[model samples]
Target: IRILPHVHDTGAFFVALLEKVSPLPGEKIYKEKDAEEREAGESGSETQRVRQPPKKKQRTGFKEEPYFYFEKDEPIWPGISQFYDMNPEVDPTHFLSRTNDGKKRNLYFTNKLVKDVVTLNQDHIKIINTGVKVLVRSDNKGADCDFRLAQEGSQVLLPLFKKRKISITRDDMVTMLLNDDMCEPPEIEKMDTKTQEQCENLESGSLAFTHKREDGVEITLVGWKGAKSVRGYVAKHDRIHYLRLLNADTSKYEKNKYQEQRDLLQKNGSIDDNNENSNEILAENGTTKNDDLENGNITEVKENEIKNNENVDNEDNGNGNGDRNGNDHEMEINKQTG
Candidate 1:
């Protein structure tokens, strides 16, 4: 049997139940038109009716009246964390790991996910029964935001971003991505200034390498903003590119020092046999020489020796052929004389 409840926006409620009970002889079935006419006749002001509209009842061999009522609890002011947990359908693609003082542990969905919760303003968001109350307020004056995760039994509230439109739960941001819609929220200047600064501080003019794979390709992007660091990203498919950028200032300093040493060596006079021997000694002890000639000389010498040996072998073969021809002519002369 169906039980229809009459719910008012305020703290009044009534329930109509379907049962096999018979009505008394003098009692008449309730009609919505009768109630409306009675309400019009009784009051002219709309302010007098705070209750919700009356629902029509079906005649199903049952006595129907106000069966039960209960008071309703006031809705709580939602925290940012409560917005994420209440909605089961929310997408968790970009999860963020937040740490405090390098030791405190806190994990939460990315700002992309939190923005959706704040946008939908679901009423059912509540704290979880077993997990830690994930909500923590930022201590920084600039970060005057409160965070909270939803508990299991909480009901969604009205949509925070809309005017007077109610939302029972947070909307999934992944659905927006799947639909090829941009899910990024409008940028708040004050809130995002620090992040923008960090992105800007990344050094420019670093090496970027592109790698191709069967499914998708990944590009390694490296830029030095300050200190050297490495990062990796999978742009497409499962392929990822690892990137490392040198510390710009430190690298420049090392280059200048090497240039100064080279200038000093050039000023001291051209590299002589003594200096070459010293360089070879240094190279043997792990230092590398900058001269290309020193590295290629051994291969060039071997090629020259091979070419000379081929020439000498050809000359010897030519002399042996001349002697054989001379011997054949001498025998012919002997035969002619005999």
Candidate 2:
């Protein structure tokens, strides 16, 4: 179905729904005869028989992942799993996937997300992409630690660490966000005694931070923490939220963190006192929205008052629109004089 908005003065839209018709078992194919032209049809070949091909066996249930034992990574799981209480229902081994690659592979917990999405690929339906990559090969070597966690994967494990012993202060959060890739976390000394000890024993990499925000919100930031500094990775969009959050409370973490946020906005030539009165709400539902600057479709929210304890109420940023980047940040930093 099609609708053209310009001509009809209605919104332009197109939509289609298809019905699935699989041939029944032992059913034969028959062509429809021309009823109008041929009235009293001749006997023999008037009804042509078109042979139907045999149906291939369809995959019934979900294809289960491999049966490799996660207990094998027992030594590895403790470092991460210790922070959060274990789920009694889920067996770690169930997360294992089939990997024929010679490199050692680690099992990541999809939290049953794969099985949840299996229906999308069933019944010959095409799946461009479905499951989130949850596990990383723990046995391999990263620059610092044996296991390198995927950015999303760390969040999957964040809950386990959120209330755990590795809470970092807000200042440390900014350090992790601003650090170069592969840099160490600055406040390793501020790490909780138990978690810090774990890091001391651990070699360079294997850096993960569970920032327990005031009022108990948890954000899991991952990076490599070496002897000196812990290097963490925050997606482009996340960086903006972090910056806005830090800036909203200048004195909460440190005066410098807020200053940095203000400076970043100014660096990008985004400042206007008049824009203060017309502030945009950045947060939505709970998270903040970051915009890509290159498309020039950036939406700005001016934090009129720096609330000492109030949260940064910015909308959630998305990259879905034609906005762009390779800048490694999700939202473009708009320099606001406020």
Candidate 3:
């Protein structure tokens, strides 16, 4: 085996091919005993012993409930189909549930091929899961439909939906996506006039929000309407994906802790540089000479004291000259009298 180089940041893998070089002697394939021989062996009537084949054991995990596809007469299908104004081509039988009882909390949808596979091989194989969740049981009293459209299946059903869909503008889409708050979603009043009119008549339930761009790129999102506000039903990652398609900001949701830490360190480094420059300036200004850095008039007081000392020194020099002259004159008079 040779290791393959990583491509596009994918994990490295290895590839090898094996071929049979030599053939082994053919062995006779054994077959199971016939029903009569097995019955005779069990009844102890056979003179020759006929070995019976081992019985196949049922898989313990096969006890799981099989998918129960919805029928045309299914009660839940009518309300959902009518509320969304589903196209005639869309089949209600494709939807299924885990429970056969009247109560189904979630409805899943599978394509014809998957449905056939599940139905045909259910007894032979164990199917863990299949299909996308299309509807959830939300018994909202105010809403006409008891089920809400799931985000995972919205794209599959969007083309077939007619009534509950609203065409929104870029601003409207951005506004809805920006409001991440679930408790208080974006209000209808904050949306555009056209969007407001579209949502005004809508009942409080899941609906589709579509936006077409000038570049011919169309975006669709699963949204919910309420009595007071409207919100998108997208998961966090899916919300980021839709926001990217609309060219809206997704930085709020896509946070990088390492980038944040780098930014914080850079900010702190700048502050430290500023502090160092400030310290150097204070040192040059001789502020460290005195502890009272907060003193406002310290420099002015020092200058004033220096000037006063100069004036006192000049006064003392003049008085000493006058006294010397007075004493010399007195000595001169005494010498003349002697």
Candidate 4:
């Protein structure tokens, strides 16, 4: 029955009453209001009390809950160490949750999913969504090259991986982060020649590269290896941030030093050897000597090449005497040919 404010003509309220069914103690019978009794309105006096039905029972939803194991004493640390230097202090069970058995290949995690996962284990609790994905899988089925880290995970793991042994240089770091594409693994020596000898003995697994600039240390992760290339991945925003770290102040000093040394070794004979390079550099800067004469020389060269090509084509496009084009074009040949 709808309830109305008796005093004024204000907004009316809707009252929907759902009938509750309670099963008998012994028998498997639920006691519900008879349809015939509900149709016929209450004939009893107002003094006689009316029994209001209880609220409908909510769904438990426990069946749909996934099987989650959060025990800390698992042997997961050793397996993950093959890919990343696993920190035992930070509980991996809290964040890095696995799906099934056998290395739990389909691993998933996020920042604030801890509380959500806990609440999901409860009755009638639900989870809408989680945070960033961290998929670390392999291309094949078996254990050849299985420990591959994804690009998205690299952003968070780069700093942690920096402390580890596997790393690359500033120049190599820049090239690997050109895009999300897989590139040739950065040379170990170029990263830091005198850093350490242990850098050379790198394995085909998850690796991180760092470039320490004036601003900050830029890092990117590389994964997998096949066909003389590895799966190098980095975020675009991270790359742009690191690119600003390039030290541009000492450029003039380095260039002048290089030019001075090169000039000292130059001689009259050596000048001709490097003249083509000098001409290219000059041409790029819009410096052309004897421009008209150079243009005429290029035109003559082009005409001579074209005439030679036409004469060669005569055999290709000709039958015996008359040409295929049937045009009265004379063949250009050298007079000294005879």
- Tens digits of lDDT, candidate 4, 177-228: 4423111233344444542343444444444554455556544554333222
The candidates, ranked best first by TM-score, are: 3, 4, 2, 1
Off by over 4 Å in 2: 1-89, 93-108, 111-128, 138-146, 161-165, 181-198, 201-204, 248-338
Which is the winner by lDDT between candidate 1 and candidate 4?
A: 4
Best by TM-score: 3
Ranking by lDDT: 3, 2, 4, 1
Give the TM-scores of the predictions, in the order they appear.
0.14, 0.43, 0.59, 0.43
Taking the tens digit of each residue's C-alpha lDDT, what string does model 2 give over 207-280?
Answer: 56766677777766665454544555455556656667666432333436567576545533434543342122
Each model's Cα RMSD = 31.4, 18.5, 25.0, 19.4
- For candidate 2, what is the TM-score? 0.43
Query: Relative to the true structure, how large is the alpha-carbon lDDT of every model?
Result: 0.29, 0.48, 0.71, 0.45
lDDT of 3 by residue, 206-241 (tens): 778889989998887776687667776566677677
- Superior candidate under lDDT, 2 versus 3: 3
What does candidate 4 score in Cα RMSD to the true structure?
19.4
- Name the regions of candidate 4 deviating beyond 4 angstroms: 1-57, 62-69, 73-77, 101-122, 131-135, 139-145, 155-165, 179-199, 222-230, 235-338
lDDT of 1 by residue, 21-117 (tens): 8888975555343566676686443333345558987444323211111112212223222432234343333232333224222323334545455
Candidate no. 3 TM-score: 0.59
What's the C-alpha lDDT at position 148 in model 2?
50
| Candidate 4: Cα lDDT at 115 | 46
